[model samples]
Target: MMLAIDFVVVAVIFVAAVGAMSCKNLVSSVLLGGLASLVASYLFLRMGAPDVAMTEAAIGAALTTVIFLVATRRTQEVEE
Candidate 1:
């Protein structure tokens, strides 16, 4: 059961990561990246590394996503 859950979570994370990379929209890409990080944190917790999981969730998922989103927002889009 646990292994099956792990496989599902890994698949989700992989999809999110690929979506993040392939997305043309900046905001969507950032959100996808954050989703991947969040899933990774859950995987870490499931593997019995709670401290690493917390750090990954806080920094990799939350802080980094916010920072990237803010940075993307601050940039003006190029108009043709």
Candidate 2:
């Protein structure tokens, strides 16, 4: 049911966040972060808070990703 789906979303988000943290490539890490944020938004929506979910989707997924990419541009590329 909804709770089961919520659990899956949380698991996926956890994995994505961990992958984002461990990634060597800044661009991929940024994308994973956005993915994690999107999963979080979905979780929020499932929890019956559409307003909060919308904000998280717009700000966490979109704006935060943009900021991370912009910040990445100012930093040195990740070394293997």
Please report the candidate that would top lDDT against the real structure: 1
Candidate 1, clashing residue pairs?
A: none
Candidate 2 lDDT score relative to the true structure: 0.90
What is candidate 2's CA lDDT for residue 64? 91
TM-score for each of the candidates: 0.93, 0.86
Model 1, span 1-80: residue lDDT tens: 99999999999999999999999998999999999999999999999999999999999998999999878766744331
Prediction-by-prediction clash tally = 0, 0
Q: Candidate 1 regions off by >4 Å? A: 77-80
Give the alpha carbon lDDT tens digit for every residue of 1-80 in model 2.
87788788999999998999999987999999999999999888888999999999999999999998887776654531
lDDT of each: 0.94, 0.90
